[model samples]
Target: MKACNERRVCVTGATGYIGSWLVRSLLQQGYHVHATARDPGKAQRMLSTIEGIDRLQIFRADLNEDRSFDEALKGCVGLFHVAALMEFGTSVQENDHVRRNILEPAVWGTRNLLQSCMRSGTVKRVVFTSSISTITAKDEKGDWKPVVDESSVTPASLVWKTKNPGWVYVLSKLVTEEEAFKFAKENGIDLVSIIPPTVAGSFLTPTVPSSLQVLLSPVTGDPKLYPVLVSVHSRLGSIALVHIEDICRAHIFLFETSRAAGRYLCSAGSCTLPQIMDIVSLELPNWISKSSKVEFNRSAPSIISSKRLLDLGYRFKYDAKDVIKESIQSSIGNGFLNSQVEFKV
Candidate 1:
């Protein structure tokens, strides 16, 4: 609500892939940052290399804990809520586990954080990181819509019928985002949600991100992730994607842009499995052997759009090829994949 030149902001889930990068980006932009993480030690380890590390403060906070974020939110003019339970390909088969472990933490955690924000009195805008699962792009008859954008939302009833851990995770995001917007509006808080498809590119976290795990399944040839990929395609008609850097940049842009309201779809584009492999092959010629084969149709329809964010003058820094290439390079750098070995799906 008020403008300040101090540029003080707080980022939750600071130890995560996006959160760490955002912290670094903010620090590079000369902001005084308060970063919250479940384990401050891990947060320190991940963020120690940041350029303006001295301007950053790490705080231990949990979404499930009421008032935990109050201390962190104090004096901050903005908040980036990036923490959420993500179970992309899980076999946790229990309704209670789904509700308790995933759903409640996401929805109620948002409430807890927002309550802290309102109490802070200084936080003017809140930027929320949302998933593409919130956009189903389906009609009443369960058919694919011609084009999907900010208005498209996946129904809770549809998620409930699937009985899938992945869909349950989607439900968490869908419900949490709705709850966030509702609370923000009722209390007169400026809130913006950035919905990203399968996020790829390098990460700052110690482990590979769950989204990257699913995105890189083709190269890893991990059989367990096949179902997850199938489910994503079944839900959104194709593997919709966004670069990690672009998504993080979008988060900051939405927070800074005064007119950015409601939800913004932040996808670079969508592509089929064959198209993904072809991009990989072209980017890293030696990574995919001639024997590697994928039979899926190459053409993938673009079902989602980012026209709102584009109209706001935000541009994506990476495209499909750049995203996949950087992801592969990061995978190799992290020792998750062997550069010398040829990969096949």
Candidate 2:
């Protein structure tokens, strides 16, 4: 892929958690940003606080609609496809709603956007934001493989067989990613996918992201979100995490690095439930107490290797503890957590 002289790029799903952060980072780095969102009003309101707001242009686009992203992709040499229909526990049974609403739209949206990319003669490289849900490898007997990496792929049939809404979302990611790779290969569009595990830390979105809700479930004791955390551990054997900043940086890094190709696993680190709880006790003592009722899965954690990204000389700015602290602090600052909670500092 050739690099463009002008620093202009388009980011879809620009109002979402990671997308919003990426827009800020790119603008800070002197890139003219064309950001796409469903509602231009919400996009303008959400992104109004960035320092380089004048350099950012908001375009209305729908992932489910063909050619919706064309206006945003114009004159941009790079595209970051960050939009997706994220649903968890939507319906008890995985039926047509799951397929029509969640799965098919994700795949179709990817195709439609890439087709627009192909038509936009200026687009040289595309960076796709993917999730860890696509990496839960299992054997024929339904046991997790010893280690999960970029090559690990979750079977669509297995996800469908469970009839779980979360797993159904997982299936959507897997299928969409597969479709993206295939289209990129056939169309000669240089593409790189950054697969991040549970993302945490400071967020730009007004409401707390779903990932944060699941991350802090131990403190909130939220019945709905706690099960999602349990499901992650039960499927992946460990809770892998990445700071929101690091994941966004990786997306920019891969997009700029001409040699970067294929899938890159972008987790900063993994921490057990006890380890996370210990950090909470030390950093935000009043948030979670010693007597907090919590149960953890005893499964041996599987390793997620980031050797490829590390080999590229990328360093993680925050470890697991730092990520946890930032997430808690952001939650408190944003009113997701009780503002009365005491901090160590």
Candidate 3:
């Protein structure tokens, strides 16, 4: 009915935000994890944080290299491919990095892992960590009331496009997931993809920003969006949101369930920008700029319904305001939001 608790699973990006949490969850479930990262030094940190877990193992595996995961995937029964360069601001986030970092690994790495899994014969299935961005959001803006789920009305934009990084990261996931689906079809590998929108909830570590920043800021105090996103901060809270752990749990649900193949939208509820601020301000008054007024974007997605996952009996821990408040508080408690943490946006 489910994978053996002793199943050896190989998790990529094990030192990253989502990756790190995924590693912990797998270990908790009695899964023996062979976790990987680009740097061996980072592996040491994972070791420290993940110490005392009897079933845990760590190694180095770069998404950019050719034979990077050869050793990592050798004998594992499952693979969690989570490494990706978010052009959120890094030079390598987009451009060649999309192909080298995301596309190659998400696409070709699946190919390589599939080959290894086929060779190893113990490999079961691959549960890919994807984003709601892959669902093709028409580049419009509006509030999706009673929101949550994958729908055609979703709004789409790439980070590399408007920001310094642009949409390369978004495009990379789209291309990679598409390729993964095609490859899985060809190889008959059980490949499942989990897509979440505007992810909230604190990272297990401080390496990345919550997806809410990219989604929320656009409609609130975003100078880049000046008139469009910022002007609508008053109404920004109505958009769809979900907690990161819920997103991760969705992947685990699919990993253990045979019928979980194909795509599933993962989300909790929706709120407006001001509403979101109202939630965060309660706990993170010092971190948030009280001076800025919240606005709503009529141009944003009307609603993102995660009813697909919910109908399947999956429950969410935090709704919009609760998730935002908990996430900000956790970050503050974790020292990521100290006065010393320098972040312009």
Weakest 10 consecutive residues, lDDT, candidate 3? 228-237
Candidate 1 lDDT, 201-300, residue by residue in tens:
9998888887887777777666666567767776677788888888888888888899988889998888887777788777666665432344555665
Candidate 2 residue pairs in backbone clash = none
How many angstroms is residue 54 displaced in model 1 relative to the true structure, after the best TM-score fit? 1.4
List model 2 lDDT by residue over 1-345, tens digit each. 333436999999988899999999999999999999999899899999998988899999998888998888888999998987667756547378767877787888889999999887889899998898887745678776877788887777777777543777687788888999999999998999999889999998989888887888776777666777777766777678999989998999999888999999998877777777777777666554423465765444577778889998788998877888898889988987774343334
- lDDT for each of the candidates? 0.83, 0.83, 0.62
**Which segments of candidate 2 are over 4 A away from where they belong?**
1-5, 142-146, 287-300, 339-345
Consecutive 10-residue window with the lowest summed lDDT within model 1: 288-297
Rank ordering of all candidates by TM-score, starting from the highest: 1, 2, 3
Count the clashes in each prediction: 0, 0, 38
